[model samples]
Structure formats: structure tokens, C-alpha cells
Target: MDMHILQALKSETRTGNFVGIATANLSSRSELIAQLCEIAGTGRLQPGLRILTDYVGASHYLLARADLLQEAGLDFVVSSDWPFDLVTNLAEAFVGGFGRATELEKCMQLFQPHFAVLPETADVPDGASRQYCSLMFNIGRSRLALMFLFDDGFILSQERLRDVGLLTAYYTSLLQYSGTTTDRDFELTDRELECLFWIAEGKTSDEIAMILGISRNTINNYITSVMRKTATKTRSEAIAFAVRNNLV
Candidate 1:
């Protein structure tokens, strides 16, 4: 994570919705906050995430970057306590489903909790639910999701789940502030990102071409390729997607 991004998040924290978590009546919320504070002091991310998983009544947790889901391997995973075989079996299907979602849909899903059913072939832990909960949030330019599997027949509190999402973002910010955030391998090329930056600045293909000394058709091709790779439908949506993920 970049310092400027962390600084921006620090400023936002002063006015962000997380400030209201303290006033919530849930005892788990308080415990979550206390544990997070302690983790902040100790600088251990996994323990904090484990605390969040327990606080939410989840049997297992997996935190990952949403944007990097298309990549090979489990490189996108930030932290996880899920069974290794389950993750291996599900990663491909997860990436495919994530890619099918439009950029607009992905943007709209930020900080919103959703549920999905695990594949029947997955080797789940005993008594864990087939249904899993996921919540997405942005930490600077990164779009991260926290997905967890709860016990069978245990009802999840929606409020606590939302609080967990917010706290996960806060926990990631703590990692950023301590310079322990994991390095990311972006999928976009240098030229692709350069084109994205220009388009985000409201430049037309021709104008960008003039600035970059490329032909208008080539510039259009770059923008189109960006849209395809990003799973966006149009130039505007592509720019919006780039901005949300901090690609520019």
C-alpha cells in the first residue's frame, strides 16, 4: 500500500462509518474493537482476522483481493484459515464467477454482504454450512473481500457481519500503516495502465494518442483491451472501475 493511500484512509477514518461501531449494542462489536486495538499494538494480522472470524461465529475465514481473482494460483489470497484442499478445489470456480460479474456490479458490491453456496465437491470441515458469507471493501486502491463459513444451522447476525467488514478494512489499514501490507502483482501492463490513467483524466482516444504519440486506432485498441480485461462494458465503466480499484 502506498503512503498517500494510507494517509487518505487515515483522514477518512476520522469521519468514516466505523466511528459509530462503538455505539452499537452488540458485545461482540466491542470485543472485536478491543481485539483489533490489541492487534494494532502487537502488529499481528492473522490473530486479528481470527478474532474477527470467531466474533462473527464463522468456522473459517479467507481474505483475498477481488481484483486478483483472475490470476493463477492462490497469490491473490491475503490470509486464510480455510482447508487447503477446499481452497484448491474452489479457486478456479471462484475466479470464473468473479470474472462474470460486471465492473458496475463489483463496484456496487463494496462493503455489502452477500452469500454463496459452496460446491458439493468441496471438502468442508465438519458441521460447517454449505452457505458462506462474503463482504467486500476497499483499502486504498485494493478491493478486498472477507469470506467465511459458519456453523451449520447457526444464524448469522447481519449487523455483526457488516461490522466485521468495516473492522477488516480497519485491520488492513493498520497493516498498511505498519508497512506490513503484502506486495501486489497487478494484472495490467505498463501501457495499459498508462492508457487507463489518460482516459481517467477525461482524455479522448485521439487526445490520448496525440499525447502518447500513438495512432488513434491504437489508442482505441488499448482502451478496448482494458475494458475486456477489466470485464467492463464501456469506456466510462472502465474508467470508473480503474478509479475504484486505484488502477490509475
Candidate 2:
């Protein structure tokens, strides 16, 4: 099944429509690797595995940041149609069964290679039950799960799975950045970021002005400028957006 997939990929590449083949003029392995590499780029998540899944036969994929688990106070699950019930149940277990330290340790330990079938009790979605292989691996600061619901006979390689892990981490990290309160380059100014931090901490413009030794009017102007630049409205909404995008 794996070889067949690769053959299909090669054939598709020749046809000139394959997503992974657009830059096939890549002359060397390093060039190929760079083209396929999404880890170091900036975004909420990398698109490498997502693109791979599309090129292959998988319907959907998910990559969760292990480090985010600490700040979010929850285990992150990235998969397609993984039942909300299943996610809630497993998240409860993750919360109860492991401490922050333990979870981090587990993520670190799995960095090389790992994959598995979800337990029978796991309430996988109807769409996912046929092929029904939910596998996980860790890479750098994140953990990822790739669940495929294609034909039962379909098989993916260990090497490919490792690539999925690496690619997923890259995507997830990039996505994490996209959702962060800070932008990748230039970043918000010190004053702007200071205001944002305070807003997230529940400070009002008047309070921020007092803290920054500026007048309330000046603080309001700064906030208005921030809203325009960030393209957000309402302080609370802005803060939420910042936090979600990893801007803060």
C-alpha cells in the first residue's frame, strides 16, 4: 500500500498537478528538504503534514502543541471529526492521569518514533472508525496525532510516519505563532505590547496610563492605534485575538 502510494505520487508528479511536485525542479536533497520543511517558518501550525495528507489519501489530520498544554490547562487534540465526547473523555483522563511534569516527560520521550491504535473505549467518530488508526508522535515542543480513515488495507511507512511527526510539529509550531499575541517579525512596539499585556491582565486604559506614567487620554490614543493596527475591536476581543494568535 505504501509503495503504491509512492508510485501514485510519482505518477501524479509527472502529471504536473501534485502539490509536492510544483517545485520538482529542486536539484538537491537539501533543496527538496527545504521546500518540504515547514517547521522553522512562522504560523499557527505547519502545513507540511496537512499537505502530505492531501497528497496521499488521508481525509484530515491534527497536530497539538505539547507546550501549550501547560498554559491552556488542557490537552490539545488535533484530528478530524475526533468525537467531542472522545476528546472530552480523553482530556479528562489526561488531566487526571498525568501531571504537567509527567506529560512533558512523555512528549520528550516520544520525540523519535511512536504510533498506535487508540483504545477500544475511545469513542472515535463514525467517519474515522473504518480505517481507524489513530497514531501519535512527539517532535520538538509539540505532540501530534495523525488519524486516517482510508481503506483498511492502506499502510503508511515508519519513515513516512516519522516525517508526519516532524512535519506536524513544524506546522503546529507555526500555527502556534499565528495564534500568538506576537507577530513573527518586527513585533508590537514595547508600549503597544505593554498595553496588550495589561489588557490581558484586566487593566483598563486609566489603569494603564497610571502604570505607564502617561495621561489617560494618551493611553486611549495608544489603544486606538493598537486596535487599528491589529484590526480588532473591543479591548476584550483584542486580547482574546492576541492570545489565540500567539501575539501576546
Candidate 3:
């Protein structure tokens, strides 16, 4: 199916409102991934890129090069325990809270970004951390995150972040069409993926229930269904599977 860009971008605002976009027609999926790898290596994008996918029957991810992040005193979270501490912490500490489903849309509507900040924290050791900024976003079954390490006096404004997020979504949509995030069988229903998405975001069962307007037990059932389907033993392992497989 072909996705209309303006229409989709117009709607990247909240869950249950996402519109499907067409795959990349300009570049091969490999070429695009390689390009991002080069960007990650160059430190132009900062600590790294984490591309998470939740689709078909699996969840998975691909991290940008590690050497680049090493220079910044950071590393990708271990897949099994990918705490994603950096994302949660950055949102809370710097931006007050993670912005809306459509962060940019909300900003445009309200005339203020959900979270925009200066990259001038004094706690960054040796100024390594100050150069970089982080944000996360979603498009369909995929979640895209990029951290940009900018020159002094430069900031990753909310508008720019949203732009990057959309671009990242474009690239990952290509990956999805190219079958890059799939390997084997693990059938998760739509309900299961919804539960997994919120779980990966650090939402508790009760919180997810409230957000989805479902009962707490129903949320738990969805999660347990995910774990069983994915052959995971614990909630974290199930989420880890989701992350690595790009299911969430």
C-alpha cells in the first residue's frame, strides 16, 4: 500500500492515529542503513542511533556503531537489559517529560515544544556529554531515536528533532519493506504489540491499562500472552526480545 507523506506527517501525533507510509523508493534499504552507519561513525549525530521495530511476529533493533559512542562515554544498552535509561532520564531531567504522541504537532498547536532545552549541563564529565542531545519518536510499529552532539551554541530544537524523527521513520519504513527486522516466527497480536510498546516505554500495567482504557488484568493478560508467544520467561526478557526483534 502507498502512504501519503503530508497526510501521514500531519498525523504522527498520537497512537491509534498513525497512517501507513510507503517504503523508500529512492535508495536501497542496504544503502540507507549504510549511510546511517557512516553518519553514526562520523559523530555528526552524537552518541548513537537506536532503531527499534515491532512488526510481523518479532521485535528487533540495530544500534549505530559503538566506537562513536565510546568517544562520548556512553554505550548501547545491553540488549537483554536494555534499560533505555538514557531516554527516560533525559526526558525527565532535561525536558521535564517526554513530549506527546505527535510532539511537533502538539508544539505547533500550543506554540511550545513539549520539551526543549539547552545542552549546557555542568555535570557532563569533561564536556563529553554536553555536545549531544537525545529524543525518541515512533512511526507505526517502529520507534526511532537519535542523539545529536552539536557544536557549542547549537541546540536540537523541537522542530529539528521532529524533522529528524520523520526522516528516521522514512528510513526504517524502508527497512520494514526490505524485511530487515524479521527472522523467524513469533506471532503477536495487535493487542500484544500495543502492550509491548507501552511496556518498553516504562509504563506499568496499570498505566498501560489507563492509557488503553482497558482493565489492569487485561493489560497483564496481553503482556503474558506476549511472553508466552515469544518464549520469554520474564517481562524484561519479553521486552528485550521485542526490542531486539523490533516488535515494539
Tell me the TM-score of each prediction against the true structure: 0.63, 0.44, 0.43
Task: Between candidates 1 and 3, name the one with more favorable TM-score.
Answer: 1
Model 1 vs truth, CA RMSD: 12.5
Candidate 1: tens digits of C-alpha lDDT, residues 23-73 = 222245666788688767776778988888767656678987776554356
The parts of candidate 2 lying over 4 Å away from their true place are: 1-49, 54-59, 70-81, 96-104, 107-110, 116-121, 125-153, 173-243
Q: Write model 3 residue lDDT over 5-81, tens digit each, in one string.
A: 12112112211101223322223334435656665434332222332121100012223211111212122232211
Task: In model 2, state the lDDT of residue 126.
Answer: 37
Query: CA shift at 224, candidate 3, in angstroms?
Result: 2.0
lDDT of 2 by residue, 1-248 (tens): 21222222222222122122232221232433575563445442334554555443444454443333332323244333434655554554443433444655565655343333445567554334232334456443234555543333343344444555555555555556444333431445778877876776557788999999999998888778777777777775666555555554
- In terms of lDDT, which candidate is strongest? 1
lDDT of 1 at 37: 86
**Maximum-TM-score candidate:** 1
Please give the range of 10 consecutive residues that has the lowest summed lDDT in model 1: 1-10
State how far residue 223 of model 3 sits from its true place (Å): 2.2
lDDT of model 3 at position 200: 68
Cα-lDDT of candidate 2: 0.49
Q: Rank candidates, lDDT, best first.
A: 1, 2, 3
